[model samples]
Target: MINLGEKKLILASQSPRRKELLKGLGFDFEVRSKDTSEDFPINLDPSEVAGFLSAKKAAAFAHEIVPNEIVLTSDTVVILEGKILGKPANEEEAFEMLFALSGKTHLVTTGITFLTLEKELTLSDTAKVFFKELSGQEIEYYISNFKPFDKAGGYGIQEWIGFVGVEKIEGSYFTVMGLPIHLVYDVLKNL
Candidate 1:
């Protein structure tokens, strides 16, 4: 367990995955987040957009942060070729995303930011996830059952699809899950 000497840890994210990951670290924190736009500049490199949004989320809590409170924010993005794939809006979009990702390798990037009343630190971790070629029936079944509308790239690494389809991963698995827990632990342990 990591201890933050007399500091109150505040997690400013709505992602249950992130919440669970943080809890696994054995740190006590409160979840506090406001709805914020996921929009990013079209010109941003897929590698950079996640970090941008992570810091943007942190800004929402800046005004209310106390001296001993450390706010954590994170954002995850899926990049295919060079474009960012956001969470799908519906089944059709979800199907398209999975189909495109079928039999291919893509980047899963997660940006994490630690903000205090005094300063801010933002960092990103990227992972390469390789999927087996998904058949139409497979995609349809997964979408109908899993309803990946809340996940980036229209899929979750901890779900059924990932269990059967993910053949390899090149980086931290926690990063693909939308929070890099090892990085989170290292950051807090050093703080």
Candidate 2:
């Protein structure tokens, strides 16, 4: 178990998966979702893109942090064919993203920001995920049934599609779930 010492932990996001993953670390924390527009410049690398977004989210909660509080923010994205696939806007887009990812390996990068009154730190973790060739029917069925509008790359590793389609994964599985628990725990411990 990771102890955060006397720092009051606060998570600044609305992702239930992140919340659950953080809770699995056995640390006490609070969830406060902040509304921040996610817009990044085109020239940034994939990891930089995620880190920038995470820092943006953390900065959005600047007014909420106190002296004894540490706020966490994170962003995850799937990069395939050198393009970043964020959350799909609808079912058709979701199917399209899945189709593009079929029979290919993609990179899943999650950036995390830890902010406190004393210091602010931002870091990123990347995972490689391989998918077997997915049929159009399979993509359609998964998108129609699961409605993965909230997941990057239009899929979740813990979802039905992952069980049926994902072939292999390299690096931390929790990063693909939208939070890198191992990295987060390490950062918090040092803090």
Candidate 3:
């Protein structure tokens, strides 16, 4: 187990998956977040968006960080064919996004940022997820029951859709779920 040694940990995100993953670390951390815009430059490569956004989220707490506090922020992005698949706005959009991902492999990239009063460290983890060919009924059922409008790529890998659709994953499973907990644990050990 990693010890904080009097340093308080803060997670600056409201993602339920991230909160759950952090909790699994057995650390007592506070969940706090700012309403930072997730917008990114259109010219950026799909692979860089998560890191950029995670850092951007971390920047929201820059002036408030104290010497004994370590603030962590993260963002996850789903990429298919070199483009980012963002959270859908509605059911139709969600269905369309999931349809596009059917039977294909995609990348899930999670960027994490650790900031103290002295220094900031930002890193990212990427995972390749292979999906089984999904039928229309499967997509509709998942969408209707899961209501994945708030999730990137219109799905969460830990959900029912993942159990039925994900054939294999080439990287950390937690990355697809939204937070790379193993990587987080590794970094936390050194903090």
**TM-scores for the candidates:** 0.98, 0.97, 0.98
Which candidate would rank higher by TM-score, 1 or 2? 1
lDDT of each: 0.94, 0.91, 0.93
Worst ten in a row by lDDT for model 3 = 175-184
Poorest stretch of ten by lDDT in candidate 2 = 1-10
Compose the digit string of candidate 1's lDDT tens values, residues 1-191: 66787999999987889999999888999999899899999988889999999999998888899999999999999999988999999999999999999999999999999999889999999999999999999999999999999999999999999998999999999999999998889888888
Ranking by TM-score: 1, 3, 2
Q: Write the per-residue lDDT of candidate 3 for residues 18-107, one digit (tens) a residue.
A: 998899899999999999999999999999999999999999999999889999999999999999999999989998999999999999
**Scored by Cα lDDT, where does model 2 land?**
0.91
Q: Count of backbone clashes for each model?
A: 0, 0, 0
Tens digits of per-residue lDDT for model 2 on 152-186? 88999998899999899999989999999999999
Error of 3 at 79 (Å): 0.3
Query: In model 1, which residue pairs have backbone atoms overlapping below 3 Å?
Result: none
